[model samples]
Target: MLETEKEKVKKDAEALQLKMYINGEWKEASDQKTRDVINPATGAVIAEAPEGTAEDAQAAIAAAKATFESGVWSDLPATERAAYLLKIADKIDEKAEELTKLETMDNGKTLREAGYDVGDAAACFRYYAGMITQPDGHTYHVADPMQAMVVREPVGVCGLIVPWNYPLLMSVWKIAPALAAGNTIVFKPSEVTPVTPTKLLEIFEEVGLPAGVANMVMGAGPVVGNEIASHKDVDMVSFTGGTKTGKHIMKTAADTMKKVSLELGGKSPNIIFADSDFETAVDYALFGIYAGAGQVCSAGSRILVEESIYEKFLARFAERAKEIRVGDGSDSKTEMGPLVSQEHLDKVLSYIEIGKEEGARLLCGGERLISDGLDKGYFVAPTAFADTTQEMRIVQEEIFGPVVAIQPFKDEEEAIRLANDSDYGLAGAVFTVDGAKGLRVIKKLRAGITWINSYHPTYNEAPWGGYKQSGIGRSLGTFGLEEFQEVKQININLEVEPIGWFEK
Candidate 1:
């Protein structure tokens, strides 16, 4: 970018004044305090947002509860609600470029990746809008003079907390479904990446959503997040972030007996058999761990290869890993951008050192990339480790960076065994030309999301979540809409008489 253009963006960014959205109004922090939002790629303060406190969170929650009770949005006919949602989707597309730039600028993702997120977020809203029109209740046949039925109802106030990785997309994942299910929400985006998140509320306003139907409070998780999770008025909490934080939210939310849904960390495996198509397997293996700088929750961070082709796979993978262009996210030629923050970069580098100490061989690009003045930003080259053992920390833990652990297995049984051996059952993939074998492996893998001969392709039509400690519930498709709904079973007796035992 030219110096003049850069200065203009910075000046415009400084004017952001990230206000909170409550009761259909934009307001500042209760204390009138604000925090600077930085450009992760340049380490420049580009914008400022409210430094909300617990009190601010409480105000948002109270508004949502009262609005829900008023039935302003909850009582709307399904078709009308769908219309509101579709309008929001249309608004998102109209502002896609603006939203995409903010996402790339604030979160340090390549423009292409950020662009995809914008489109997907819009698609998410449309998907749920259509879903709201579908049948969501059932009736059952029973004995004469008696009737039974099951129906879906909104779960009242919902607290939605999204991670910084895909700020706009993740928030929309929870927001669209909650709105479709007729639930009010108090939403929180990652404090460090609040720019793109605030734009969604603007879209809500433009689309004429009802007051207090959706609110946003931005601040540290300890204060605002804890308030939302533990608030008695917030009926449920849906969080997507680290496992440790997810556990904390789950425990705190238990006090109010609030329903909790968490999409947590993962160390997913990508299994490639000897019979797999060689070039395709090698290409997707790189795409799996390196995309998003390997910060994805379901990132395929571990690669378990069949022994016969293991060496070839490692060679091709390392060759391609070194060639990935790492630089400013705005540069269209840059294939990968910096990590979201400096602190996260340090954590990922420390993991590389730990891998070395654990005796795992560094295959390629383990150090921070300091070329072309990239050292000013938090950039790390695509990294890989070979000969990793199942017990190694790098292999077992969720690195959440551009790091991959490549291990060789002797047979299909061992490959499946190694893949299933993890605390996270979030996602995994098997690449093989033999369709029957790939199907068998996919079935045997222990994870909520799995793929055959492909990696990192997700659909709004499919359920997304994990097993074991990864998460408690699913997101996307019909399941995503149901997450914010409570089921009720109604029974009626046609006859006016009661049982004889009651009379006695």
Candidate 2:
């Protein structure tokens, strides 16, 4: 975050011009306008991508539609599609180190976290590759001469809008499954962070994915994203971002009656019981909200502890949070990095002020961090508040930053009540030594994914989604592949006996 660091990143930025990929080639925006890509850590311009317009988005959609209808890739054997996906996975693994560094520089996340994202992206591609080779439908026999079977088919061209939190990982969450289902893609990466997605397009080209089968267009939400949602040629839209934007996309895609899948915001809860392991619970509580500087959609931003241990746990948690390393993401020792942008940093700081106005007690870390040469970076200290009520905005809303609120509950019933009082139910966690108690609490929590004695540990094989306002559909497993497919029932007659059943 020093001047020299900014100069170094500026030099790197000058070497690359991130362009849009469409119709098997890289090009500029239709208007030839480009936007600077910033390194959040140093507040430096690291690269530039096209400020694509509606025309660019439409072009990508048209290319995908043509590829899907032409059957150049969609009609190929499932195993062959799997082969291409597997090769992409390998390529991702090959460039894992470089991609990690790029992600760190581009998104202001620690290099360690970026490495995990890269690894997860590769695993997601490989997971979908295996899924595509499995049987796809079910056969049914109806009494005498009737037979029927249901088969899954591609849902034509898909529009994918990914968020900036996990730039490459979120893209793979959609891209891997969409490709495995033999559907063409027109993807729009978050304009704030497009470097990794641009690199992903290079991998796609190197893997020999069929021409026009996949395209990447980078721009703001209203221009590129809305175009993808409302374009008539696009048959489906899969979006991951804030709840408001997801709702807008759903409404836009409704014009064409397109299939839609969404993964939105969360105000997740992490409830710790008196019977939980003290040390491990404390560690995971930190990991839940502090990792990625709490930009994750499923961050356990609200912590509920049993009244008996509330004071002790909160003290330890607050002390540890103050010690979290905040600096340039390229540093291996840095545990947390800057917020993704100046706007987001401001938003998080405003919420901290709101928390104080609501009379919530700030135990530690309520101000922006400007120390150890991190003055130029948009850094915020990991903040925690206690004596917060469910009605407080700090406890009820998705701060989406390194800010968390802790509340105490009287009993198990009250714990569940406090956890489910929010409008968002994306994910939650329970920390208890008793297995039966864990099951009881988890079954009652209204969340798509819940962890026992753990938090934020997701698997590639599991169905990832939320129950209520969190999302409309699932991703990351068999359920994810099904989202990109359409079901059709075929009927046949085995016996055609001449029995004057109908008057001819």
Candidate 3:
């Protein structure tokens, strides 16, 4: 039955065309070009998506712009807009199985992880739907004769670019709030893993999202992403990707002075103090960097251990890292799957070599793994490096792979310093039993999100983003809803009086 279910999912995904959705219609690229969507697990072509160009992006932008300006969606009451989002959430839940399979097949993560991501995507939409109806704006009274009010309104058409990792979940992080807040959207899923987002557009279509309200254009970053960022019609650009791309988007969007929110790269620290629950810290330390094959932007790739426990922890961690089961995504027993693509696999492997060249000791499992009858898939064993300095590239840079750099610190001050040493400050974790000490360490960490005694757990209700080069603005929570909105203030005069000082 398990094999049968797997076969069914594989069939369904292959049957899909993976086309773009623009102006309420499924369509191909303007030039009629297509690209193969490869399954990273097997290096097979699971489906084909449009190799969209700037012209295709223009169409999507125009659709979004026309829809927003039409006010068909934008003029609706917040509750009315929210109802549609709630339905999208429901639809997402209904199609969870199919979406999960496509996601796993496309991105090469375990099916279990993909399913969780699907559930999170649904929850994200629901969270925004409820938030949209809550009392927004504020009223203030200056005097008996004067009153003032401030209201939140949508920021016109928005452009959202999500990374290949966590494609659907990240897309929902931007799409849900943008839609619930009454803004139309032109969304670009990473060309590398466009399957689930393609599936999401199908759901949007089935749920009857208004024509031109939401659009999908799939292609390389240069063509699709660049057009969306620089397009005059798009009012805001929200991107989740590398810091370099985020910077490019920021600069491009600046031509029109558009609002830009970026959730970019990270080299976050996982600090394991000797005072913490030893076993729990060890487990999470592995989870933090190994989960998602460390493609996650908030991945705790830099681990700082107290000097006393450093050697002991390193030995245990390396031994456990070697035990991780890496195989095909379809295999129920597989703990980790392939990297997303051959290109990414090569990039990660190169980083491993660079880590060695930079003098970081490879404790274990730095090379690619090919086994279990899988030769073409991109698989890397979870790697741990010890005897690392703060200045080493492996410690400082954001290497988005299942490779972690372990360093030892003398005390609390040194740990804090090491954690804050990187240019990326997306997320960090502090493991300590003493509540006051944990809190103190958290306060000193420069990351946007800090976990105490845990790592890599995020809630839909909590804002997610980063500081420094880890990207700007926040996603999720009420703050996320506000990201797509513009605040407008109005003043009213209760008394019918004309100001003599004003020349009428």
What total of clashing residue pairs does each candidate reach?
A: 0, 0, 0
The digit string of per-residue lDDT tens for model 3 on 218-279 reads: 99999899999999999999999999999999999999999999999999999999999999
Q: Would you estimate the TM-scores of all the predictions?
A: 0.96, 0.97, 0.96
Q: How accurate is candidate 2 locally (lDDT)?
A: 0.92
lDDT, residue 411, model 3: 96
Taking the tens digit of each residue's C-alpha lDDT, what string does model 1 give over 1-504?
A: 112223433455445767899999899888776777778788887677888889999999999999999999999999999999999989999999999899998899999999999999999999998989987688888987879999999999999999999999999999999999999999999998999999999999998899899999999999999999999999999999999999999999999999999999999999999998899999999999999989899999999999998898889999999999989889999899989888899999999999999999999998888778887788999999999999999999999999999999999899999999999999999999999999999999899999999999999999999999899899999999889999999988889886677655
As a whole number from 0 to 100, the lDDT of residue 378 in candidate 3 is 91
State the lDDT of candidate 2 residue by residue for 336-416, as single tens digits.
999999889999999999999999999889898887788888899999999999888888788999999999999999999
Candidate 1 residue runs with Cα over 4 Å from true position: 1-15, 497-504
Regions more than 4 Å wrong, model 2 = 1-15, 497-502
Better structure of 1 and 3 per lDDT: 1
